[model samples]
Target chain A: MNAHDLIKEAIAEKGKFDSVYWIACGGSMIDLIPAHELLQREATTFTSYIYTAREFDIMRPRRLGEKSLVIACSHSGNTPEVVEGCEIALAAGATVIAQTDNAGSKIDSGKWTTWVYPWGEGVPQAEVPAGISLSLAAELLDQQEGYVDLADMYAGIAEMDKILPPAREKVNAELGDRFAKLCQEHEFFYILGSGPNFSQTYGFAICSLMEMQWQHCSYIHSAEYFHGPFEATQDGVFYFLQMGSSECRAMDERALAFLKTHTDTLMVLDAKEYGMEAVPASVRAYLDPVLFYAMNCELRAARGKVFDHDPDFRRYMGVVEY
Target chain B: MNAHDLIKEAIAEKGKFDSVYWIACGGSMIDLIPAHELLQREATTFTSYIYTAREFDIMRPRRLGEKSLVIACSHSGNTPEVVEGCEIALAAGATVIAQTDNAGSKIDSGKWTTWVYPWGEGVPQAEVPAGISLSLAAELLDQQEGYVDLADMYAGIAEMDKILPPAREKVNAELGDRFAKLCQEHEFFYILGSGPNFSQTYGFAICSLMEMQWQHCSYIHSAEYFHGPFEATQDGVFYFLQMGSSECRAMDERALAFLKTHTDTLMVLDAKEYGMEAVPASVRAYLDPVLFYAMNCELRAARGKVFDHDPDFRRYMGVVEY
Candidate 1:
């Protein structure tokens, strides 16, 4: 079976339980933080974690009894931490669900329920796997009964490829000017979001970590912007507020009110203003933030005009070693 | 009433509650973060927060009911947020306990149990009201059974005073050299801690904000250190770890181990190594980290002896008004 079908079955089959722990390193666990945030609000113990293999071996949580689900996600399947975490979780009596890119990889040898994604046509095999793996794990934990329509998720994946080509060209045209101006400036950029978009707050830091390459960037909830930090919002501070649904709308309003209090640098990206060249609203603002963030982050990267040139793309954070 | 007696009475009265929500801003809140770390583990929902009066007016938790306690702390009893938060909590039916240094300040106007500290001789009366106020708050919170012993805490506080005189001299003496080396060499410094010290990790940022005074700084928990940024610990990096009890002990070990791995630029101040100087292990290594931090922060102001003649005392990131 294809990677997509395998993932769908695992999402459909996992029984409802008392606790859910999603374990993986970096993006594997990061993509699921929003899902866990939603799940935790439902009064269940839910956690999404990122750890190296050696650290995982020394500090694995106890109990994976009948009511527990341990979702081990690793796009490469060979990632040391994800494999070890899967092994440890299974030995502790927890039900393991492994999402891997390569079906034949050793990660498939674990006792957990396995899901695999194959390299799709024309799409780079590496990126598609992590995104697909995460989408599968999110589907299982999304908890909205009508939301399990796997076909819809698969269909939505096409939205990015169809629209991104034009957005890329449009951004590339203006990127050089923006990058020059940004490089000349001595200021800090602050990204603000609220509610479900709170998960996307991590996006700002990760983008800085992986792309724009600035350590002075920070992301805070929109409501928190009004606190003392607001006083620091001089012309030197660049503000980016996520203007999607989620509860971010209300926070967006508050943020707008705050911006009105001063004549400074506040950039608001209202997705509604962009019109629906994207997906449907039924996707929920919580989930939509990621899509909106991917677009927003892409724009930022294009404006910065920085991209990896290395053929082997060495991760700045290094290999996921134990 | 004497500070110790009033603190004991307040604790005896608050022992009936299962959870607490401590509220303050700036120095008042920074002091409480260390204590709340212990309280959070001992209770069901112990959460302490720092917020401005404006933010409190908006998203203050509604109808606290009888399930919690709100300890509104302000060294001066004049901080607008603490006074307003105390009033809001009282209105919401939660028991509000006010810890302050002034008996006639605005916070005293709230309908909550109050404990005030008398300004001591020689110490700048206005500079550290929150320190004494927090000591009182800690005593009250510890009165609730086997959490923390008040006598031991005071003894530890007293021991800290003795340890400070000599360490303070030594560090202050080296301030010029340290400042010159840091400013001339490093682009940034990352302050780290775990468990109890994690609560005060922000204190390092606050000090860097007040002193360093132009250098960029970031703080993170030790568990989070390994997640991504630890890889950056090359010869150019400067790291400071706050040594405290609880997970601080384990994190200290991990940090020391990490230092051995990447030797060039790591500087660790392990409390365990302090030996008899940091007496009364019952004192909870938590508070000791803060005491040492307060002194180390002085190095920021001494900056290569450049600012010795003209101190930049302007409040940059301190208390703000809407």
Candidate 2:
């Protein structure tokens, strides 16, 4: 079934839901963030949350029951924690929608509905994990509370299919060499982002930079940077800012202005600079994270070439058990 | 009014509420996290969230209305962002309970209710910001969905009043010199914690270590460390784990065990090792963060004395305009 149909069926089976939970781990969890942010910003009838799968399984929120809708993702569909979370949600009689790139894996063993998206080359933008999750959220919001810009959000997703490739190429051509140089020069960095875009900032810092390249980094919310993290700013410190095209842009701009003045080693990737005018303004904020995700992948690849470290190399991750 | 009485009055005036938002910034924001976690874990009738004041003010959730309850804190009560959030909540017709150390400050200028907690020496444990916030959450849970362990929670708070002073003294005597030495030896550290204790982990890393002492640090959720951040863990890297006495303690222990193998420079502050045996097991987890907060203050002070950097010293906080 399509994403919308799956959401509609889930709602039909449950009758109504007062809460929605997005559960996953690592980059999968990060991919679900913008969708959770959508519900947080728009849905008045229901509350939503993003949880790391292991924490969700351990904490076991008391609200996870028949009236709850849980949307979970695991790239391999085999992450033990996410699979366990799906089982728990199913046991609570919640409507569970499991999204995965791997079909017929452990996650598919559950009684919940499954949506499989393509993982490799030439895949449609909407077929990616983030796109599918956002579509599910938008569909649920529309079915439950009537999202006014649901059509526009779909249009934004379509526009992404056309714009993201060029956008990634542009990022590689414009910022790749500089990013690679910076990676070579700095041993550590502070990444700043706000609103939905902070998910990409975190993914790029922890999953890409730290996990892939073994770089030390910290991701700070643009607004919260002013509170305490900004105190660590100085001439020698490195800062990378991901500027968003949303209501929270003010916070990002504030951080950018401060970083520009305080540090010489500051880099910024502003979504507005990329060609996103084809996307609707109403849905542009939600799409900013998608664009940044593509750009981050390009930048990571560039850094990998310069450092001679494969972005896919892992020291412990599938290689050894914790 | 007392914290519980204030919550009761707010609910009485509102008639009913489906959501609660805890809004603040910096340490004030961190202090509210345990309360937010309490609702997330126990209250099935209502949903709750923690938001940085600026983000809450800007994003302005559509759910903030007559059926919404907002509890905000600002240490001095004049934090512009939090004051703005209180005003926004009031304007939306949401019931607002504003907690502050300074009673007559700007937050009190709103039509919302205000609860004043003492800030200085000899303050009872239950009269502090974290304690008051937790009490408000517990009261709301008890009134809304009947929290079974409400009395035990209060008893735990009373027990804290007796145990915390000696706990702080013990932390200073046992770990002070070693922590100071580590601070001098290491230029950066990763602070790890899970469940509600992660709030203290974040508060210590960002607010105390980085903001006050100009140290570089990143706060990693213990469960999340295995996902990506663990790849950056190695022998020369420093790690400080805050072990909780709760369901999520398993995650902390997992991270601790892995860190012990991967890095020689690791420190752990385990709540179970302290004198928390007298606190009810059911409520002990909720108070773990409180104990860790006090312990962190002691450790920060020890480092401060070693480096001669006053814990209150700030390069930018109130000194410069952002």
Candidate 3:
């Protein structure tokens, strides 16, 4: 059976996987957060725990055992912490699922899984990094939400595929120049979100700005605005709010109302405002992160051209004995 | 019973607490992290969760119920989020343990237990807000490690009290002037820590600087250094590393090694490096945050003088509407 079928079969099986442990770090951890949040909303019988890859390596959570299902990911297929986690989970007699950018890399020794995205015709289908997270979420949801929900999600994905081009074109043509112009003008940025969209808020702040553009940015939760982080807010401060139609939307609305009063440079990327016509209302909340990613790329695309630095190149990633 | 004995009795009662829910925010949340971490380390039967106070108010975890013990704190006893969290957790039938500087504060209502620090008797006996967290931790540990272990911690606390005078005197006499000289040198500062000390590291960064002193700072986890925040590290960048004992020490060591190699301005606050002779090995690991707080105050003492900012004054704390 294929990876999706295998995952569904595992979920369908009785008396298995009483607990789900997600072992991931950095980018992988960010991606898993949405699925983790969704699982909390949907799966009542499943006790879920998420640990940073190194913490998992060190703590070896007591509940992880024969009845546990460990889902770990590393796009590079050789992230040291993920590899160690997989090895330890396998040794503990827990079922292991590995997600990697390449199939034959170090992360492939466990239950094999891959996420393939369809490329244009005449070009081979591309296996994208971190795509497995989305597939993993959908497969798990297939058990609770039924195959029809999965079908609806796919239709939504296809619908997004159709409208994404024009959306990107419009975003680039209109907001791209504006983002590029305003990007450097702000010394620091704070990105805020709640619910599943929180992952994008964090990913954009850390990945797109900190790691990619070497800019100063911090991600704050919408539920935490009145806390200490808001002390830094001022009239001219820039903030990007990734608002979605999740259960925690009220939290974001409250935060946005406060930020709008405090700062003039507030940008709200509402998933509802975007064209999501084909997405069923029942499953729309789950797609917020996916839609947020599409919107986040616009800022990334604009900043990539404006800045001289390449996001891929790192000074100390694999250099000099780290 | 005394507070310590009462807590121990609560823990000993059969099936009274199946889980622990820590409801806190910002500085309060940071103070609670060490206790939360220690609880996770010691409590095997207990399922524990730490949430920002507002998040706890909005999301209210399904696990929080009659069988859960919710520990929530606010120094001033008037943080709106903590008040809401206390109300919600009490309404949900969870036992509430409230920590505050004042016993008569609003958080003491509705079947709530309180931890009140002595603020009188000339020069205040140094009402360290984080001290409440450590005491709370010791109370919980009283169940697992017994009263003898808690006694050892109290002895360590007394020992630190003896040396703390000299430490503070030296910090104020010698380092105070130097810090004042270099107060405005850096644009932004990063605070790093691991293990129990992580809480103090976060509290010092957010509470002492951002909220109180009106400065910019960010607290990054030591294990997360390589992920995104490390991209901003450079030759002249300053980072204060609150290295400590406990299980996660190795994680901080790795991050410190990298920071030392890259930056000449690395400040390492090692509890062992300082005069901690009176502190016993059995309880030394837990004193990391306590010791780190002492060292952090030196910086605060210095900065408060140089910047013409009182750490106690606020622009919009209880004085204004949210």
TM-score of each model, paired residue for residue: 0.66, 0.98, 0.84
Give the worst 10-residue stretch by lDDT in candidate 3 chain B. Answer: B120-129
Worst 10 residues of 2 chain B by lDDT: B7-16
Worst 10 residues of 2 chain A by lDDT: A116-125
TM-score (C-alpha, index-matched) for candidate 1: 0.66
lDDT (CA) per prediction? 0.53, 0.87, 0.68
Measured on C-alpha atoms, candidate 1 has an lDDT of 0.53
Tens-place lDDT per residue, model 3, A92-168, is 87777776666577887645343323223222111222334545666665664444466665555445555556656
Evaluated with lDDT, which candidate comes out highest? 2
Q: In model 1, what are the clashing residue pairs, if there are any?
A: A3-A116, A3-A117, A54-A322
Among incorrect, acceptable, medium and high, the docking class of model 3 is acceptable
The reply for model 3, stretches above 4 Å from the true place, is: A1-14, A38-47, A110-174, A275-287, B1-4, B8-14, B119-183, B275-286
Q: Which has the better DockQ: candidate 1, or candidate 2?
A: 2
Using lDDT, rank the candidates from best to worst.
2, 3, 1
Window of ten residues with lowest summed lDDT in model 3 chain A: A121-130
Pairs that collide, model 3? none
Winning model by DockQ = 2
Model 2 scores a C-alpha lDDT of 0.87
